[model samples]
Structure formats: structure tokens, C-alpha cells
Target chain A: MAKISMIVNGNPVNANVDPRTLLVQFLRENLRLTGTHVGCDTSQCGACVVHLDGRAVKSCTTLAVMADGHEVKTIEGLAADGAPLHPMQEAFREHHGLQCGFCTPGMIMTAVDLVHRKGHELSDEVIREELEGNLCRCTGYQNIVASIAAGAKAMAKSDLA
Target chain B: MYEFKYHRPGTVRQAANLLVKNEDAKLIAGGHTLVPVMKQRLASPPHLVDLSHIEGLDTIEMKGRSLVIGATAKHAEVANSAVVGEAIPALAELAGLIGDPAVRHRGTIGGSLANNDPTADYPAAVLALGATIVTNKRRLKAEEYFQGLFSTALEADEIITKVMFPVPKKAAYVKFRNQASRYALVGVFVAKRPSDVRVAVTGAGSDGVFRVTAFEDALKKRFSHKVLDGIAVSADGLNSDLHGSAEYRAHLIGVLTRRAVEAANAKD
Candidate 1:
């Protein structure tokens, strides 16, 4: 077992984990932070997206040992459970971004990072291009694109972008 | 995934020592490609050496006439680097177009070159730029470094410390990327140097990333699209799969090479 220390969801976490435990597995199974889903255990699906030291990364492909001493933020920690919805999440609800809700967490996480990198006032074309990694089998991505644009704008106003 | 021992070596010497000591060991940078393969049970090295703990292996700076990028420099860093942009904007663009934003944040140039995935974007750039790969032991020119698909001249204990790319007069990379994964379909990188012009193509070769001497010779005569007007690359030995046929890739090799040369000459 490898002993690892990291900050997850803005809280300090230390644990003895198997060498093979993935970051997503540690988040979902160890800490019970199931908010970061594992849609595709392979790296193709971004459902296990999370923030490592303020940058977005695919947790499914990141080993827990590799994330040692790093800061990881999941969807659950985006705004806490009940305080208030983050602007990105709010935009998703406002624009009806999700259909089956399976890919929402990854979408929102990826969208926030996109806004952070590409600026909040993103074009529909840019959003469509930026979302090349994350896939939504439902809704044909029309509402998702609109939600991301609105979310990026909201994030800009919130000074979070 | 198979269980293994993880070692985060703080220095290249220590990492090399660990690799030499461990019978079954693999050096991992960023773990974007390595971890996925491990999960698939395709590769399961008993000892995984994580290179992130090393200090100086992630630096990107201009050293004299060459842009020296350390082994662990992430794609995002390269993409956003002013040094890379100024030295070779096409190289920076290639780095940015690798995978997606998150993957770019985690994937490293060293890992990509070390893996030598034929579909990867950096091989074309490295080959076309005539970059010298600096390893812990020795230096290798791009021509000698890349042997074939998923192959490099690196020995088991050797670690890539830095890659030194001589700043060309002008260069650009044009990729016909896979629609979903965005791996290059027939990416062409054209570089014009004081000595000679180099044209490297990735994702279209049976062996791996290779140069187009015909295009290079034509571009050397006159670096323009019309110079390559009738240069027809033979379809033999090119890659053929569900995404593209050998003839299609050959045809694309012509078109993208022209575009790359135009893009290269247009900037300067």
C-alpha cells in the first residue's frame, strides 16, 4: 500500500491506498464522493473529470499515487451540496443542458475549466470545438452548447472564470 | 489493472537508477497514455517510475538557437508558452491540438515522443523541426531516434532528459485529425531552415512518421504550393484502415503538405 496525502474538495485527505487505485476510484470509493462518476472506465469518457491543482484532468486515467500531494476538486465541491448552485450548474439547469443526467457532472466540470482557459464569453463554435473530449449521446448537444455559453458568461460575471 | 510498485524519483539520476535496478520497470510521465494501457491490461510493468517529482525536467526555455523543452513539460505549458509561440508557433499549435484540454494538461512531450504513437502530433513536429532528442546518456537526431511505430531508439534504462529543437526559419503543422479522438489522420509538418527544407508526415506511414523527400526537394527549389503542383506520392507502404485508405492518405499527404508549406511561408 502507498500512503498518499492530497486535498480533495478543499479538504485535506490522507490514506493508504492500493498502488493501482485510480483517482476516480479513490474519490468515489474511498471518500464516498460519488459525485465524480465513472461512465467509461477507459479514458475516453470524461465522466470522471476532476480538478488537480486548479487544472482539469481525467481522473479515470490518473492513478491515485500520481495525485499525491495535489489538490483535487470534484463536482460535489463546486459549490457544496445546499449552499447555492455554481453558475455553471445554474446555467445547465437554466439551459436544460442534460437529458439523462449521466454526462452532466463531467460536462459542467469540463465547461468550467473551458471558461477558465478560453474566457467566459465563448462562441457556440468554440464551445462545440472545446467539447471534443466530452460526449453527450442525448440532446444532440444543442442545449449543451447554449448552456456552456451561458455558463461561461455567468462565470465571467462571478469572476470565477 | 495489475498492481505495481510506484516510485516518485526526485531526480533523473535516481529515476535511472531505479529503472536499472528494477527488472520490470516503466517510466511514466503524465500517465495519460500509460495508465490507459495499464487499465486495458496491455502493459503492466511491475514498477512504475513517476517522473513528476523531478524538479528541472519540466522547464521550457530558449537556449541559444534551440528551444529546449524538458522531458516532462506538459502539452498545455507548451501550447501557452510564449517561448514556444515565438520560436515556433506551429509547434505550439500542434501541442495545443493534442487530445483535448484536460489531456493536454496531463500529457507530456517526452511521453508522446517516447511512446512514438504513429497517430501522435509531436512526432511530425519533432521530425520536421530536425530536433535533437537529449537523453540521459546521449543525444540522437530525429532521424535516428524514431525507428518505427510505437518504437524509439531509447534503451530500457535510458530516460529522455530534454529535446532541443533548432528554431527553423519558418514552420507549420497541418493535421487532418481523426474526427472524434483527433489523432492525426495525415498530419504534415513543414520546416524551412537555412540548410534544407524538411517535410514529415505522421498517421499515414506504415513504418511511422517519415519525411517526403520529393516534396522537400521541390520546396527546396521554390518554397511554394505551385512547386508541389504535380508531385504525386505513391500509395504503396502507406497506412490503410477504416478511417482512410492508402490512396486517400497519399492524396491527403499531397494536399496537407501544400497547406503546411503555405502556412509556413505565409507567417514570415
Candidate 2:
């Protein structure tokens, strides 16, 4: 077993985990943070997407030990308590960005990171390009990109307000 | 994935020692490719030595006329690196063009090259740039490195420390990407290094990435698209998949090579 410490959802969490435990497995199984879903078990699916030190990464491909000392933000930590859904989540809901909720959390997490990095000016082409790794079989991706753009504008407005 | 002992060695030397000491060990950098294979039960090793914590393996530095990219440098780092953009813009574009943003954040150049998937993008860049693969033991030229499909000259436990790509006069990567997975269906890298021109094609050939000698010679003489019109590459030894036939890949190699050259020569 490997003793690992890292900032998880803005809280410092430590645990004794098998060295071979994947970050997705550790988060979903051990920590009981089942908000992050497992889609393909391969990195190809974005169902296990999360923020590692503020950047999007497929948690399924990352080992728990590799995440030690780093900050991890799973889908569970996206919105603050008593606060409305994070702008991205709200946008997804408004835009009907989901058919099944299986890929929603991961898509929102990845979209949030994309908007944070690329900002609101991103074109549909750019969004599609950025989302090449993330597979969304349900929405056809138009709504997903729209949701991201809407979320970006909302986040910007919130900041200005 | 089958259960295995995992070691996250903080230092490169420690990681190398662990790999060497273990009889059935594989180095896992980003795990973007390895983990997937492991999960499929395609590759099962007794130990996996994770190399993420090692310091100095994530750097991108300029050395003389070349760019020195640390082995563990992520695709995102390379795509956003000013050094890579200024020195070799094609490399930056290629890095940006790799499998989506999530894969870019976690995938490493070393892991990609070491994995050497036949359809991978980095092989074309490394071969076209005439780069050097600097290992713990020795440096290998790109021509001497790639042997065949899913094959490389690297011995077990010989950890790659850095990849050195000399600044080419001009370079560009044009890929016919697989629509869903985004793996290159047929990708070509065109580069002019000093007076010499190199054309390397990936995804198309059964031999993996290889230079187009005919295109290289023509480009060497004229260095333009018209010069490549007369050249004909045989369909033999090219890859055929559901995406394309061998002939289609052969044809694409020519088309992408020309486009890449034109893109390279286009004004910034």
C-alpha cells in the first residue's frame, strides 16, 4: 500500500491505497466520490475526467500515487454548498447538453477546464477540436459546445458583477 | 488492469535502477496509452515504474541551434511552449493536434515515442526534424531508432532522458486524422534542415514512420509541390484499415506531403 496525500476538492485528503489504484478508482471506490463516472475504462472516454492541479485529465489513466501532493477536483466538488450549479452545469442544463447523465459530469468538468483555458471567444470548430479526446455519443456535441460558450459568458459576467 | 507493484520514484536514476532491477517492469509515464493496454489485458507486467515525480524531466529548453525537450514533457506543455513555437512551430502545431485536451495534459512525448504506436503523430515529427533520442546510456538518431511497426531500437530499462530537435529552416505536419479517435490515418511531416529536405510519413506505412526518398530527392531539387508531381510511391508496405485501403494511404502520403510542404512554405 502507498500512503498518499493531496488536496482533493480544496480539502487536504490522505489515505493508504494500493500503489496500483487508479485515480478514478480511488476517487469513486475508496473515497466514495461516485460523481466521477467510469465509461469506457479506457482513457478514450471522458467519463472519468477531472481537474488535476486545475487542468483537465482523464482520472482513469492516472494512478492514485501520481496524484499525491497535487490538487484533485472531482465532479463532486464543482459547485459550492448552498450555491446553484456551477455555470457550466447550469449551461448544460439550459442547453439540454445531456441525453443520459452518464457522460454529463465528465463533459461538464472537461468543458469547465476548456472554457477556463480557452475562454469565451472559442468558435464551434475550436470547441470541436478541443474536445477531440472527449467522446459524447448522445448530444452530437452542438449542445455541448453551446453550453460551454454560455457557461463562459456567465462566468465572465459573474466575475464582472 | 491486472494487479501489479507500482513505484513512483522521485528521481530519474532511482526510476532507471528500479526498471533495470526488475525482470518484468515497464515504465509508465502518463499512462494514456499503457493503462488502456493494461486494462485490455494486452500487456501485463509484474511492475510498473511511474516516472512522473522525477524532477527535470518536464522541461523544454533551447540549446544552441536545437530544442531540448525533456522526456516527460506533456503535450500541453509542448503545445503552449514559447520555445517550441519559436524554434519549431510545426512541433507546436503537432503537439496541439494530438488527441484532445485531456490527453494533451497527461500524455508525454517520451511515453508517446517509447510506445511508438504505428499511427502516432510524434514519430513523423521526430523523424522529419532529424531529432536525437537521448537515453540514459546513449543518443540515437531518428533513422536508427524506428525499426518497424510498433518497434524501436530501445533496450529494456534504457530510459529516454531527452529528445533534441534541431531548428529546421521550415517544417509542417499534415495529417489525415481518424474522425473519432483522432489517431493519424495518414500523417506527413515535411522539413527543410539547412540544405537537406526530409519527408517522413506516419500511419500510412506498415513499417510505421519512414522517409519518402523520392519526395525528399524532389524537394531537395526544387522544394515545391510541383516537384513532387512526378514522384510515385508504391502501395506495397503501406497500411490498410477500415478507414482507408493501402492505395488510399499511398495516395494520401503524397497529398499530405505536398500540403505539408506548402503549409511549411506559407508565410506566417
Candidate 3:
């Protein structure tokens, strides 16, 4: 077992985990931050997306040791303490970006990272193309695309304020 | 995933020494490919030498006429790098088309080339652009490096330190991606130099990424899509899977090559 420490959702977390433990498993099982889902274990379904050192990566494929000394932001980290929903979260709620909600956390995390990188000027084509990793079994991704576009604008507006 | 002794080496020399010391150790760069395989229990290396902590192994810069990308540089870094964009726009574009954003942030060029997945995009670019694979021990031309699918000429203890890509006069890559996985179903990379032209195909080969000499000959004569009008690719030695037949892949080789040539010409 290797002792690993990282800042997760603004909190410094330390754990002694088996070297084989994946980041997603550490987040869900050890840290109890279960908002990061694991729909496809093979790293395809993007259901376990998270921000490591401000870049979005598949948590299911990342080893816990790999994330040592890094900052991890999960779905649970999006909103502030007793604050209103994040702009992206609000946009998802407003646009009804999800149905069964299985892929929402990952989708929202990925959208936030996309907006963080490309800003509010992301085109519909680019949004769709950027979303190749995340899969949605329902809603046909029409609302998800709409949600992200609106979310990008809201994020930019929030950044200004 | 099986338990293994993980070593985080701070330097390339330390990493190389660790590799030599451990008989069944595997190097992990980005862990995008190795982790997935390990999770599936396909590979059970007794020790893992993680190279993420090695300093100076992730730099991207232009040295003279070549763009040098350190081994551990992630796909996202390559895709968004200004140096790569200015020196080799096609390489940056190809990096952007790899896996998805998440995968791009974690997948490294060295890992991709070392793994040499037959469906990978970098092999086609490396081969077509005539890049050099720089290992800790020595530097090898791309042609001398890639041996076959999931194979390279790398020695057991050797580690790739960086890749030096020669700036092409003009180049472009066009890929037909698998709808589900985003891996190339058939991808073609075309590079046109002042004196020579190179064309490489990936994903459709049964053995691995291979060059299309016929397309190269035609492009050498005249670097235009029109030159490939009468060219044909055989189905033999091509991959046939649930996604596409060998014959279909053969046909796509010709079509994508033509498209790549047209794109390269337009970029010129």
C-alpha cells in the first residue's frame, strides 16, 4: 500500500491505498465522494470524468498514486458552500440536459472543463465534437448541447461578476 | 487490477535504472493505455515504473527545423501547443482528433507511439512526417522504430525521452473515426517535402501502420488529389472487423489518401 495525498474539492485528503486502486475507486470508496459515477469501467463512457490539476481526465483510468499532490475537482465540488448552483449546474437544470441522470455528473464536469478551455464562444459543432468521450443513453444529447452552450455564457457572465 | 510495486522516478536515468532492475516492470506514461489493460487483467506486471515525476520530460519546443516534443507530453498539450501549431499544424490538428478531451489530457505521444495501437493516429503522422523517436539510449527514425502492432524496436530497459518531428513543407491528416470509440477506422496522413512525399495509413492494416508506396509515388510526381485518381489498394493484409471489411478498408485507404492530399494542398 502507498500513502497518497491530494486536494479534492478544496480539502486535503490523505489515504493509504493499494497501488492498484483507481482514482475513481478512491473517490467513491475511500473518500465517499460518490458523485463521480462509473458507468463504463473501460474508460469509454466518460461517466467518471473529473478535473486533475485543472484538466479534465477519466477518473476510472487514473491511478490514485498518479493524482498524488494534484488537485481533483469532482461533481461534488462545483457548488460553493450554501451557495446557489454553479452557472453550469443552473444551465443544466434550466435546459433539462438530462433524463435518467446517469451521465449528468460526468457531462456537467466535462462541459465545465470545455467552457473553461474554449470559453463561451464554443460552436455547436465544436461542442458535439468535444463531447465524443461522454455518452448519453437518453435525451439524444440535444438538450445537453443546449445546456452547455447556455452554461458557457452563464459561466462567462459569472466570471465577470 | 493486480497489485504491483510502483516506483516514481524523478529523472530519466533513475527510471531507466529501475526498469533494468525489475524484470517484469512496465513503464506508465499518462496511464491511459496501461491502466485500462491492467484493469482488464490482460497484463500483470510485477512492478510499474511511473515516469510522470521525471523533470524535463514534458517540454515542447522548436529546435532549428524540427519540433521537439518531450516523451511525456500529453495529447492535449500537443494539440494546443503554439510551437506545434506554428511548426506542424497538421500534427497539432491530428493530436486534437485523438481520443476525447479527457483522453487527450491523459494520453501521451510517447505512450501512444510505444504502444503503437494499430488504430492510433500518431503512427500515421510520425511515419508520414518522418519524425525521429528519441530514446534515452539513442535516436531512431520513425521507420526504424515501429516494428508491428503494439510493438517497437525499443530495448527492454530503454525509455523514449522525446520525439523530433521535421517540419514538412505541407501536410494533412484525414481519418474516418470509429463512431463509438473515436479510434480511426481508417486514417491517412500525407506529407509533402521539397524533394520527397510520404503517405502513411493506420487502423486498416492487419499488421500495423504501413506506408502506401503507390500513393507516395503519385504524390511525388504531383502533390495533388488528381494524381491518385487511378490508384488502387488491395484488400490483402488489411484489417477486417465488425466495423468494416478488408475490402472496404482498402477502398478507404485510397479515398482518405486522396482527401489528405487535397487537404495538404489546400493548407499549402
Candidate 4:
């Protein structure tokens, strides 16, 4: 086993893990940070999306060792200490961005990263294109797209984005 | 993924030494392609020398007349770089269209080229642009580097450091992408440089990325989409799959090449 250290959800995390342990496995099995779901074990499903050094990456395809010495942000880290929901989360809640909720965590995570990269103003076409990685099994992309649009506008309003 | 000892080498020489010592060691850059194969049990290298710890290996800069991109440069870095956009817009655009944003954030050009996946987008650009692949050992032209599908001329211990792309007068890439994976169903890259015209095809080649000398010769006479009106590569050795027939891919080569030439001639 290799000892790995990284900052996950703004907390320094240290763990002894197998070399084959994926970042998703480390988060879900090791730390019990199950919010980053693994919908499809394959990289096709964006269910394991998380921010590695502030950029969205599919943790399912990432090695735990590869993430060493990096800062990772996940769904649990979004709203801190009984705080209100993040703008994207609120937008999803308000706009009904999910149905079965299996893909929600990854969707919200991907949406947050989208806002970070493309900024607070995003066109529907751009959102649809950028969201090619994330899949909603319920086929609820219309609502998810709507939530992201509203979420971006809300993020633009507040500094909490 | 199989268990392996991980090494984070600080320098290229150190990484090379690790490869030589371990013998079964594999270099992991961005791990997008290698890790996936390992998970599927397609490969199981006993040791992985992580390339992330090396400093200044991901820089993108203009050297003399070429844009020299460091080996570890992520697809997203190449896609979003101002120099890449200004120097070769089509190359930047090609980088942007690779995989998804998440994959782009993690996928490196060096890994992609080293793997030489036939469906990848970079090889066409590399071949058409006549780029030079700089390795720890020596630099080779794109033609000599790519051997075949899932193959490259890189020796076991050699490490790719950078790719120097000569700026073309005009260039563009057109791919009929598979909707699910966004890999090219049939992609064509057309480049008009000061010296010569080059047309490279990927995704449709059974032998991997290849140049179209017929199309190149036609463009030499007249560098216009109209000149390629009647051109069609034979379907003899092309890829035939459920997604498309070999004939269909061959036909796409003609249509896409024409469109790529038109796109190249279109204004910045």
C-alpha cells in the first residue's frame, strides 16, 4: 500500500491505499465521501465528477495516487458548516434538475465547473455541448440545462459562486 | 487496474533511468488512456513513472517558426492557449473537440500521440502540419513517428518531450464524429503551407493515420475545394464497422476533405 496525502473538500486527507485505487474509490470507499457517485464505472458517465485543483475531472478514471498533492473539491465541500445551498444546488432544487437523483451530484459538480470555466453567462447550446460528458439516465437534460442556466445567473449575482 | 509501484521522477533523465531500471515500467502522463486500458485488463505495467512531478514540461511556446508544445500539455491547455489559437486555429479547434471538457482537463497530447489510437484527432494534425516530435532521445518528423494503430516509433526507454508544429499558411480539420464518443468516424486535415500541401486522414484508415498523396497532388495543382470535387480514396483497406461501411468512410474522405479545404480557406 502507498501512503497518499491530498486536500479533499478543503480538509487535508491522508490515507494508505492500493496503487490500483481510483480517486472515486478513495473518496467513496476510504473517506465515505459518497456524494461523488459512480453511475457508470467507465469514464463515459460523468457521475464521478469532482474538482481537482479547481478543474472538473472524472475521478472514476483518475488514480488516487495521481491526485496526491492536489486540492480536490466535491459536492460535500460546496456548502460549508450548515450554510445555505450553493447557487447551482439551489438552482437544481428550484428548477427540478433531477428525477432519480443518481446523476445529480455529478451534474451539479460539472455545472459548477462549467460556471468557473465559461463564466456566469452560458448559452443553452454551450451548456448542452459542455454537458456531453454527464448523462442523465432519466433523460432529464432539459431541466438540468434550465437549472444550469438559472444557476449561472444566480452565481453572477453573488460572490458565493 | 493492477497493482504497480509508482515513481515520481523529477527530471527527464531520472524518468529515463527509472524506465531502464524497472524494465517493465510505463510512463503515466495524464493517465487518461493508460489507466482505462489497465482497468479493462488490456494492459498491466508493473511500474508507472508519473510524469506530473517534472517541472516546466507542459509549457507551450513559439520557437523560431514553429509552435513547440511541451509533451505533458493537456488537451485543454492546447485548446485554450492563445499562442496555439493564433498560430494554428484549426489545431486549437481540434484540441477543443477531443473527448469532453473533463477528459480534456486530464488528457495530454504526449500520451495521446504515444498511444497512437487510430481514432484520435491529433495525429492527423501532426501529420498534415508536418510537426516534429521532440523526444528525450531525438526529434523525428510525424511521418517517422507514427508506425501503425496503437503503435509508435518510440523505444521503450525514450520519452516524448515536445512536438514542434510548423505554422501553415492555412489549415483546418473536419471530422464526422461518432456521436457517443466524439471520436472521428472519418476525419480529414488539410494544410496549405509555403512549401507544399498535405492532406492527412484518420479514423478511416485500417493501417492508422495516413497521408493522401492523390489529394495532395491535386491541391498542389490547385489549392481549392473545387479541385477535390471528383477525388475519392479507394475503400480497399479502410475500416468497416457498424457505425460506417468502408465505402462510406472512403466517401467521407472526399466530402470532408473538400469541406476542410473550404474551411481552411475561410477567413480568420
Candidate 5:
């Protein structure tokens, strides 16, 4: 076992874990930050998406040791303390972006990252293309795409305020 | 995943030394490929020499006529790099078309080339662009480096330090991806230099990424999609699976090659 320390959702977490423990497992099992789902253990499903050092990456494929000394932002980290909801999260709720909601956390996380990187002017084509990793069995992508666009606009507006 | 000792080396020398010391150790850059395989029990290295801490191995710069990308540079870095965009726009575009954004953030060019997954995007670009694979021990041409699928000419203890790609006069890559896995069902990369033209195909090769000499010869003569009008790609030695038959892939090789050529020409 190796001792690893990282900043997760604004908190510094230190734990001793097996070298093979994935970042998703570390987040869900050790830290108890279960908002980051694990729909597919393989790297295909972006259900384990999270921000490592400000860049979105698949947590399921990342080893806990690999994230040592890095900052990880999960679905639980999006909202501020005592805040109602993150702009992206609110947009998803407003747009009805989810059906069964299994893929919501990952989708919202990924959308936030996309907006953070690509800005608010993302075209529908770009959103669909960028969403190639995250899969929703409920086939609720139409609303998800709308939610991301709305979320990006709201975030951009907030960035100016 | 199985138990393994993880070693984070601060320098290329330290990483190479660790590799030499451990008999069944594997060098990990981004861990995008290795980790998945480990989780599936396809690979069970007793030790993992993580190279993420190695300094100077993730730099992207232009040195003379070549664009040099350090081994640990992630796909997202390359996709968004100003240097890569200015020097090799096609390379940047290719990087962007790699796995999704999440995978792009964690997958590195060195890891991709070293793993040499038959359906990978980089191999076609490397081979077509005639890039050089630089290692701690020595530098090798792409042709001399890739041996076969999931294979390279790298020695057991060697570590890829960087890759040097000459700025092509014109180049483009077009891929038909497997919608589910996002891997290429058939991808073609075309590069046109002042002196010669090169075309490489990935995902469709049964053995691995291979160049299309016939297509190259035809493109060299005309440098246009029209030149490949009736060119036939033999189905022999091509991959045939549920996604596409060998004949279908053979047909795509011709079609994508034309598309790549047209795209390259438009860019130029």
C-alpha cells in the first residue's frame, strides 16, 4: 500500500491505498464521494469523468497514485458551500437533461469541463462530437445537449459578473 | 487489478534505471492504456515505473524544421497546443479526433505509439508524416520503430523521450471510427512533401499500420483525389470483422485516402 494525498472537492484527502486502486474507487470507496459514478469499469463510459488539475479525465482509468499532489473535482465539487446549485447543474434541471439519471453526474461534469475549455459558443455539432465518450442508456441526449448549451451561456454570463 | 510496486521517477535517467532494475516492470506515461489492460488482467506487471514526474519530457516546441513533442505530452495538450497548430495543424486536428476529451486528457503520444494499438490514430500520422521516435537510448524513424500490432522495436529498458516530426508541406487524416469504441474502423493519413508523397492506413491492417505504396505513387504523380479514381486496394492482409469486411475496409482505404488528400489540398 502507498500513501497518497490529493485535494478532492476542495478538501485535502490523505489515504493509504493499494497501488492498483483506481481514482474512481479511491473517490467512491475511500473518500465516500459517491457522486462520481462508475457505470462501466472500462474506459469507454465517461461515467467516471472528473477534473484532475483542471483538465477533465476518466477517473476509472486513473490510478490513485497518479493523482497524488493533484486537484480532483468531482460531481460533488460543482456547487459552492450553502449554494443552491451550480449553473451547469441548474441548467440540467431546467432543461430536464436526464431521464433515469445514471449518467447525469458524468454528463454534467463533462459539460462543465467542455464549457470551461470551449466557451459558450459551442455548436450543436461540437457538443455531440465532444460527447462521444459519455453514453446514456436512457437516450436522453437531446435534452442533455440543450442543457449544456444553456449551462455554458449561464456560466459565461456569470463569468462577466 | 493485481498488486504492483509503483515508482515515480523524477528524471528520464531515473526511470530508465528503474526499468533496468525491475525484471517485470512496465513504464507508464498517462496510464490510459496500461491501466485499462491491468484492470482486465490482460497485463500484470509486477512493477510500474510511472514517468509522469520526469521533467522536460512533456515539452512541445519547434526546433528548426521539426516539431518536437515530449513523450509525456497528453493528447489534449497536443490538440490545443499553439505550437502544434502553427507547425502542424493536421497533427493538432488528429490529436483532437483521438478518444473523447477525457481520454485525450490522459492519453499521451508516446503511450499511444508505444502501445501501437492497431486501431490507434497516431500511428497513421507518425508513419505518414515520417516522424522520428526519440528515446533515452537513441532516436529511430517511425518506419523502423513500429514492428507490429501492440509492438515496437523498443528495448526492454528503453523509454521514449520525445517525437520529432518534420513540418509537412501538406497533410490531413480522415478516419471512419467505430461509434461504440471510437477506434478507427478505417483511417487514412496523407502527407505531401516537396519531393514525395506518403499515405498510411491504420485500423484496417491485419498486422498493423501500413503504408499504401500504390496510393503514394499515384498521389505523387498527380497530388489530387482524381489520381486515385480507379486505384484498387487489395483486400489481402486487411482486417475483417463484424464492423467491416476486408473488402469493405479495402474500399474505405481508397475512399478515405481520397478524402484525406482533398482535405490536405484544401488546407494547403
Candidate 6:
């Protein structure tokens, strides 16, 4: 067993992880931070997407040891004050972005990263391009793109304020 | 993923030493491909050497007329690099068009080339640009480097520290990308070096990425897409999956090659 320490969800997290422990496994099985869902063991599905040092990455492909010195933000980290939803989360709720909610957390996280990178000036083509890794069978991408577009605008307004 | 001793070596020498000690030890650069395959039980190494912590293995240097790219350099870094854009814009564009933003941030050129998945984009670019595969032990020319599917001339302990791409006069990559995996169904890389013209095709053949002598011969005669009007690619040893048939892939190769030539010519 290897003892690994990382800044997870803005808090210092320490755990004993097996050498084969993936980041998604560590987050879900070890720490009980089950917000990041594992859909496919392969990197094709973006259901395990999370922010590694503010960049979106599929956690299943990332070993837990690789996150030893990095900062990770799962879906659990997006909320604040233990009450309110993040603007993206709120936008998803308002725009009817999710259906089954199996891939929502990863989709939201990836969108958040995109909004942070591309800002409110994102086009549909740009959003589609950024979402190449993420797959959502339920939403069919229409409402998800709508949610991200609205969320980007809302995020931009919040930043200005 | 299968259980294995994970070693995060601080230097390439340490990683190489680990590899030398254990033949079963596999180098994990980006984990974009290897880890997933491990989870599927397709590949399981007794020892896994992680290369992320190794310093100086990610530098991009312009030495003389060649752009030397560290093997561990991320796809995103190459796509955004000013030097790569100035020296070889097609390379930057190819890097940018890889999987997605997330994959680009994690996938390394070294990892991609070493894996040599037949459908991968980098192999076509490397072969067409006449790049040298710089391993710790030897420098291999493009023709002498790639042996077969998911195989290379790299030795067990040999680590590819860098790749040297000669500054091309013009080049372009055109690919018919697979929708789900984002891998190329059929891709072509066309480059104009000082002396000769090179055309490399990937994702269409069982031999993996290879230069097209017919296309090169035609392009040498006339450096235009019209030169490739009558060239016929035999589907003798091509890959045929659900995405496309061997004949379909061969057809796409000609189409993409013409498009790549046209794209490169647009720049010149």
C-alpha cells in the first residue's frame, strides 16, 4: 500500500492506495467521493471526467499516484457553502440538460473547464469540439450545449459583477 | 488495471535503469492508451514505470534546421507552441485536431508513436516529415523505425527522449476521423522537404503507417493534386473494420492524399 496525499476538492486528502488504484477508484471507493462516476474502463467514455489542476481529464485513465501532488476537483467540489449550486449546475437544472444523470457530473465538469478556458465567447462549433471526449447518450447534446451556452453567459455576468 | 509496482522516476536515467533491470517493466508516459488497455486485460506488465515526474523530458528545442520535440511533450503543448506553428504549421494543426482538448493535454507524441496504433495520426506525420526517432541508444530513420502493428525498432530499455523533424518547405495532414474513438479512419501526411516529396498514409493498412512510393513518384513529377489522379492503392494488406472496408480505406487514402496535397499547396 502506498500512502498518497493530494489537494482534492480544495481540501488536503490523504489515503492508502494500491499501486493499481486509478484516480476514479480512489475518489469513489477509497474516499467515498462518488460524484465522479465510472462508465467505461476505457478512456472512450468521459463519464469519469474531472478537473486535474483546472484541466479536464478522464480520471479512469489517470492513476491515483499521478494525482499525488496535483489538485483535483470532482463534481463534489463544485458546490459552495454546502447549499447553493454552481452556475453551471444551476444552468443545467434550468436548461433541462440531464435526463438519466449518469453522465451529468462529468459533462458539467467538462463544460465548466471549457467555460473557464474559452469564456462566454464560445461558439457551438467550439463547444462541440471541446466536448469530443465526453459522450452523453441521454441528452443527445442539444440541451447540454444549450446549458453550457447559457452557463457561459451566466458565468460571464457573474464574473463582471 | 492489473496490479504492478509503480515507479515515478525523477530522471530518464533512473527510468532506463528500472527498465534495464526488469524486462517486464513498461513505461507509462501519458496513460491515455496503456492504462485503458491494461484495465481491459489486453496488456499487463509486472512493473509500470511512470514518466511524468521525470524532468527535462518535455522540452521542445529548435536545433539547426530541425525542430526537436521531447517525447513526453503533451499534444496540447505542441499545438500551442509558437515554434511548432512557425516551423511546421501542419504539425500544430494535427496536434490540435487530435482526440479533444482533454486528450491533447495528456497524450504525448512519444507515447503515441511508441504505441503505434495503426489508426494514430502522429505516425503519418512523423513518416511524411522525414522525422528521426531519437532513442536513448540510437537514432532511427522513419523508414527503419516502424516495423509493424504496435511495434517499433525500440529496444527494451531504449527510451525515445526526442524526435527530430526537419523543417519542411510545406506540409499538411488530412484525415477522415472515426466518430467515436476520434482515430483516423484514413489519413495522409504530405510534406515537401528540400530534396524530395514524401507522402505517408496511416489507418488504412495492416503494415501500419508507411510511405506511398507511387504517390511520391507522381508528386516528384508534378507537385500537385492532379499528379495523383490515376494512382491506385491496392487493398491487399489494409485494415477492414466496421468503420470501413479495405477498399473503402484505400479509396479514402487517395481522396485524403489529394486533399492533403491541395491543403499544403494552398499554403505555398
- Please tell me which model should have the higher DockQ, number 1 or number 3: 3
lDDT (10s digit) by residue, model 6, range B79-128:
98999999999999999988877778789999999999898999999999
DockQ of each: 0.86, 0.79, 0.90, 0.84, 0.88, 0.74
* Residue-by-residue lDDT tens digits, candidate 2, B27-68: 988888988888788998999998888899989999998899
TM-score of chain B of 5: 0.99
Misplaced by over 4 Å in model 5 are A159-161
Q: What is the interface RMSD of candidate 2, in Å?
A: 1.2
Off by over 4 Å in 6: A81-83, A159-161
Clashing pairs in 4: none
Report the C-alpha lDDT of model 5 over A1-161, residue by residue, as the tens digit.
Answer: 89999999889999999999999999999988899999898988888999999888899999999999999999889887677788888899999999888888899889988988888888889999889989998855999999988988998867421
lDDT score at residue B69, model 6, on the 0-100 scale: 96
Better of 4 and 5 by DockQ: 5
Clash numbers, per candidate:
0, 0, 0, 0, 0, 0
lDDT of 3 by residue, A1-118 (tens): 8999999999999999899999999999999989999998998889999999988899999999999999999988998768888899899999999999989999999999998899
lDDT of 3 by residue, B1-268 (tens): 8889999999999999999999989999899999999999999999999998888899999999999999999999999999999999999999999989999999999999989999999999999999999999999998999899899999999999999999999999999988777789999999997689999999999889999998899889888899888889999999998999999999999999888888888885
Whole-model Cα lDDT of every candidate shown, in order: 0.92, 0.89, 0.93, 0.93, 0.92, 0.89
TM-score of model 4 relative to the true fold? 0.99
Backbone clashes in model 6:
0
**B1-268, model 4: which lDDT tens digit per residue?**
7788988899999999999999789999899999889999899999999998799999999989999999999999999999999999999999999999999999999999999999999999999999999999999999999999999999999999999999999999998999777799999999999989999999999999999999999998888989987777899889999999999999999999999999998945
User: DockQ of candidate 4?
Assistant: 0.84
- Fnat: each model in turn: 0.82, 0.82, 0.89, 0.77, 0.84, 0.68
Better of 1 and 2 by DockQ: 1
Q: Say which prediction, candidate 1 or candidate 5, comes out ahead on DockQ.
A: 5
Candidate 1 lDDT at B191 equals 96
Q: In model 4, how large is the Cα lDDT of residue A60?
A: 93
Winner on lDDT (3 vs 5): 3
In candidate 1, the residue pairs with backbone N, CA or C atoms under 3 Å apart (3 or more residues apart, or in different chains) clash, namely none
lDDT of 5: 0.92
In model 2, residue pairs whose N, Cα or C atoms come closer than 3 Å (at least 3 residues apart or on different chains), thus clashing, are none
Model 2 per-residue lDDT tens digits across residues A1-161: 88999999989999998877889999988889999988988788899999999999999888888899999998779887777888778889999988987988888888888878888677888777777667788888889989877887887766421
